[model samples]
Target: MTTAKNDINKRIQELTKALETKSARLNDISNTVIDETGKGHMVISTEAHADYQKTLGEAREIKSLIEEQKAHLDIERFPRRAERAQLCGPGRRPDRARQAVQVPV
Candidate 1:
């Protein structure tokens, strides 16, 4: 369980870093300007705009992956009570003292 938790955390970190890089690239692309000769106005090219959109999409995907990793980490850190009970087997309780009680007839 510890190893699994560690792996999930590592994956989340990796995804977060990737998202950051993609965001940075998107910002750079958005700020890019194309110089059109004889026209004093700075404008972005179609290709640069497309690149920004693609990077933005990638960043969104990475953000989703990070969220999934966080969910996995949460599960690993705090397993559901029902799952723990299941591990005790059928007709068995988690508390041994409760299991030792005798029913009065």
Candidate 2:
């Protein structure tokens, strides 16, 4: 379990780095290119937006892996969840004195 968690953490780190690099590239692309009109005009970089979107998708996949890893860690910490639940289950009712009807004294 620890090994799997470590592997997933490593993958998350790699994906984060890749996403940051792509985001930086997009920023660079946005600033590149001056218009010939010499007027203050703004143009959108469709390719850069597409690249950012792809990176976002990869980041979401990484986020899912991270959530899975967290669940794995929780299970590792609570290894006997099933046994604990059985010991203190909601289905089992406790014996109550009020339930036992007493006869006339």
Candidate 3:
């Protein structure tokens, strides 16, 4: 579990860094001036805009992947009640863990 969690974290970090780089590049492209037809007209980088869109899509995918990893971790951390009882409820018998505890009443 720890290994899997660490792997997921590492992937998330890499994806985040890649996304940041793409965003910065997109911003730079957006700021660039492509062609100056006249004082009233100017064109920015079309290729940059396209790259930005692609990057944005990739970022969204990364975000979703991160969320999925987190959800999986949570599920692992907190299992079903019966499963828990089976693991630590009774004397050595895990199958009998779900049985109700006896009382004097």
Candidate 4:
């Protein structure tokens, strides 16, 4: 279970990094270009536009995956937390030894 949680955390980090990279690329693509005349123009070729859209879509997908991983991590923690609570709840004595019953002949 710890391994699984680690894997999920790694996946979330990977997805988050991918999403950030895609978003940065999208920002670069959308940035206005300054021409020699000091004029700023947002000129995006159809191919570039398409690429931007594709990258945006991929970023959204990665975001969704990150959310899923987070939810999964939460779920993974819930059982451990519940078990701990059950063991250490009020009036609970986990360290106590059970008494043995004596049998009458």
Candidate 5:
């Protein structure tokens, strides 16, 4: 069983890895597309189309990974804060917000 903080950290690491891979793939796709487009006449229709499709696929996969990581982080944090907020309802209760005091005099 993973503690909430540990789970959050693990998810953060996963997200970072995913982001790095996504960035590299995106850059590669962008370079390919731009290079092909720049050479208008020499660029074959099939090659350009293939690069566009690859870029789209990479983007979609990255989006999915990000959403998955976000869900994990949300799930980890939600219980502690969200559950308390729900139980407490809206508006802060002054008693709960402040510590008790004692008069020495």
Candidate 6:
């Protein structure tokens, strides 16, 4: 039973790692698309443009898969409930991790 649990944990970790990697790759591809679109000259060869579009499509698909996997993991980890932010209001932002709001009387 313990071995099975450990295996499950390992699989989860692997999935998490893959999701992170794919997310980063997706970001890179998106940035590339943005950069290419920003270029003033539309001088890219037809073949190159086609390749870029293909890469962009693949990146989008991979990103979707990563998100699906992430959602599945979230459900596995928090089966009964979603995150506080998801279930409630805006909730805490990481940028304001330790800051507290002050109120005056």
On the 0 to 100 scale, the lDDT of residue 11 in model 2 is 68
> To one decimal, what is the Cα RMSD in angstroms of model 5 from the true structure?
5.2
lDDT over C-alpha atoms for residue 100 of model 4: 23
Ranking by lDDT, best first? Answer: 1, 4, 3, 5, 2, 6
**Looking at candidate 6, what is the lDDT of residue 15?**
57
Tell me the spans in candidate 4 whose CA falls farther than 4 Å from its real position: 32-43, 88-105
Query: Can you give the TM-score per candidate against the true fold?
Result: 0.64, 0.43, 0.51, 0.69, 0.51, 0.42
Candidate 5 Cα outliers beyond 4 Å, as residue runs: 1-5, 34-52, 86-89, 93-96, 99-105
lDDT of 1 by residue, 1-105 (tens): 577878888888888889889988987996787666758677888899889888888898999888888877776767655665666666777676345455577
Each candidate's clash count:
0, 0, 0, 0, 0, 0
Candidate 2, residues 1-105, lDDT tens digits: the string is 577657756765775676567556656766654574669765546775676667667656766665676676566657555555455455543333233433567
For residues 1-105, what per-residue lDDT tens digits would candidate 4 score against the true structure? Answer: 689999999999898889889989999877733353556544667777888889888888999999999999999999877766565665555453122222466
Best by TM-score: 4
Predicted candidate 2: what Cα RMSD to the true structure?
9.0
Per-residue lDDT tens digits for candidate 5, residues 9-98, read 676677678767766765765565434456663443567568667766876776687678778877777777776665555675434533
Worst 10 residues of 4 by lDDT: 94-103
Q: In candidate 2, how many Å is residue 99 off? A: 36
Error of 2 at 16 (Å): 6.2
Clashing pairs in 3: none
**Superposed model 2: Cα runs more than 4 Å off:** 1-42, 80-105
* TM-score of candidate 6 against the unseen true structure: 0.42
What is the lDDT of every predicted structure here?
0.78, 0.61, 0.68, 0.78, 0.64, 0.56
Q: On a 0 to 100 scale, what is the lDDT of residue 88 in model 2?
A: 49
Candidate 3 — what's its lDDT? 0.68
